[model samples]
Target: MMSSPSPTTAQASSTAVAKRIARTARLALEKKFAVVTAQIDRELESAEDVVIDCFYNADSRTSQLNKDDEYVHLLKLRSRQPFSLVKSIVLKDGEYEGHVALIMKQAFPFAFMKLNMEIRKHVYEYLFESEEKVIRIKTKTGGQKLPYAPGYNTYNRAAILAVSSEVRLEALPVMYDRKFCFESTSILMHFLLQICDGRIYLTDLNVESYVGSTARTSFYLLANCKRLRRIFFKHISSNEQPKTAIKNFWNDAQPWLTAASAGQGDPTAALKLLVFDRTAFHFRVKDPNSKSTSVKAWQLADHLVFVKGLKDKLMDARKV
Candidate 1:
């Protein structure tokens, strides 16, 4: 720690700003889960009025830009990188999908680059700090000392990158298979365990509840073994998912949100800080559901949050 506050603190906000970057991830993941669960229950009840076939065309639909808004702006043509620009696998549930998009870099097209090393993907997020070792300098206004520091401070930066090109699951060999969710969930658990060691918040764009499901569940998966941090989400989807899906998402995710949306002057930071002070904060995003993640994350800041849902056929691989 330093004795005096840094001078440049006034020039910048001096706080660790969560870098927002542009990205497109698996859409309505929680909703997908909810829908499938509902669909399954309905199936059990023999409810057959819903037409469940138009969602995923088993045969490759023409791959092109669908000109959709952010949340539903999934499925696009990649200008670069041969492997999946789309993060994870989109499983076709009987009704909708139990798809998975990777926030961690799934894998690089190493064969093209020929690095001869396995591509390790991770959602490495650091907010405003350019570097890891950020020291805060609290500012004082009234009668006396600040909280042992000044309101101004400075730090370097963290890894920030937006999805430069379009990412599409259709681009990758991923198919919408319904039988693989539980197994897939297990694999996701394994991957989360391997990379995530502590209570680190994994941010995401909430296409649904914005802050909760996208951010909380991602963090919870990582927090399974450890305590979790602030997992903030910015909403990026339209309101088309089943109402039950939305409710279940909120029901499961609100605790994290209520806790995460705690103190601090900046609503965003306060929302994010809610995670830091408590066990974990499940943040739904603030953006509209129609905004694309790439638009939201990239256009907003220098870095964006991505959770890597490992692309491996998780059933085959053992957790490290």
Candidate 2:
């Protein structure tokens, strides 16, 4: 019973409805795209942080990119830089990926290997050598329990050794030429173990010696230092039987002495100086079981005799 609508009006209404549906679809697609873009941005930021941390915080100079596949992909996409470039890259505040690319592009392009051997040696020495008279080696994680001299300067140039393998190989010898002073025999042993073959280049060393397996092991390792020129041993007294302490001293010392005496050249040819503390031959040990109120020191006569014997042995070894 109702009148039919005009064709033009119906066509117009249909067109309006179609336009509305299209607008809604467009808005929904836009919202979806916005969400995806934001997620991608967050991922990129996270990946950058990971890359920066790896570049700076890694314990060794090795690639740690396998930790995260996504970040690894991100890094690969960002840049195909060499490990040395990656290592030498340092970022400042507010800098990001674009800046890193710019830096990589602008950094010195001359190959280090292209330099003359003498020039390369000079560069290595400049970087690895410390102005400090003595470099004090400390444990990676420990309290500073040992007393250090106040006036003397100490340095830590070990970071250069971690730059790259090529750099390490060339710089190690220069680094080891320094006068290293350790707080204790344990620390000296640890240092020697850490350096591995680098010990062969060590020329000078100073250490406080305690009567223990650690000291013995340290001396045993010292035999590997075929180029050693001088060693200063500071005797540290501990609670043990006098005879046991003296025997431990001899046991710890015998290996290095025998090696030096048996050198390819003159006896004691490898060592320019062999120093010992003034009280090196003397020992004061307390018997835990003894109720004696006073501790007995080694007899001065026996101490002098031991000192003379050590001196005579050293003199005999030093004769050309």
Candidate 3:
């Protein structure tokens, strides 16, 4: 029989095998990433705004984007790339709320161009820099400090994008099927509220949901916004029921009227224009006693004229 190989030789062989496996895995991931990027580029060729939905299921081998006008194209990342990306970020419960959202300042089409190989290498290092480093820089320069805004310091993905100049991508760990009592609109709210700078022109406020006291929240949001020139509510389908909470909240004191009454220091005073789309105040109601509470195709829409009345009141108040 041939002499047994030395223990050192066997260890070397095992190390070689591990290296090969790692190389193979990285190459596979790179290929998958490249394919996804190519489809995104194709979408950018025609669509003005291309959104890349990196949301992927672990069990699924493909990531797809809806072909509708809402989304430009689909990215099928059915490989280790998605898993690897997930690993890069830490997941904490109740860290942020509502939905798993990424504060994407630049669309994926544009971000891809910005995050080249060389740039990516430095992006994470800058992002993960310590507070000590930040303090040192500030102390050395004694530069003007950033603005102090309460409920605005939480560093969500959007905040990271706002402050950083790195070629890095940030993702928030999302609770897909998990349910929570208080939905977290903190990230999106901060993003919307921070745009109050004089140079930023907010022409539209698209309300996506009305389930979670969104009306009241919106009331406060508009109360603080000074530069909003026009406002529009998202189209509400006839099948959707109007939230009683919203009606009850506004019943106490109409928001627009109250804002109009304020003498000064009221942000809503900047509002000179209001656009009411088809779904601005349209609501649906189904008889609860009916055996079938399902919404009927012929359900007539009832207009919530309360807002219209408030508008008239505001106009008269302004005239006086």
Cα displacement (Å) at residue 1, model 3: 24
RMSD value for candidate 3: 26.2
Candidates sorted by TM-score, best first: 2, 3, 1
- Please provide TM-scores, in order, for all candidate models, with all chains considered together: 0.18, 0.52, 0.31
CA lDDT for candidate 1? 0.30
Ranking by lDDT: 2, 3, 1
Q: Write the per-residue lDDT of candidate 2 for residues 1-320, one digit (tens) a residue.
A: 99988999999999999999999999999998666544432222334322321212234334356845533222221333333343345456565633433222312335877889899889877766555777777675556533333333345446667767987888888878879888788888888887788989999998876647688888888887877888987765634444555455656676787686674655544334576676554445546798554434455665555545554555664663
lDDT measured at residue 74 in model 1 versus the true structure, 0 to 100: 22
Q: For model 3, which pairs clash?
A: 65-74, 98-184
Estimate the overall C-alpha local distance difference test score of candidate 2. Answer: 0.64
lDDT per residue for candidate 3 within 1-320, as digits (tens), equals 79988999999999999999999999999999777666543221223343333433233434344556353334443222223232233335574534343333332223644566667544544444343322111111236322232332235323444434332233111101111111122322444344444113333344333433344554565554444455443333334334442345354325643663467554334334444345434344557788455443322233444344444545565566
lDDT-wise, the better of 1 and 2 is 2
Candidate 1 per-residue C-alpha lDDT over 1-320 given as tens digits, one digit per residue, 9 for 90 to 100: 76765677743544334221111223456667656544322111112542221232223443334547323322222223333333566666755478563322223333422332232111122233223232222323567422321221343222122222222211111111100111122233333444332223233211212333334454355423212233322332332222333444444444443334333232232233221111112323445786643212222111112111111211112222
What is the clash count for each candidate, in the order shown?
Answer: 46, 0, 2
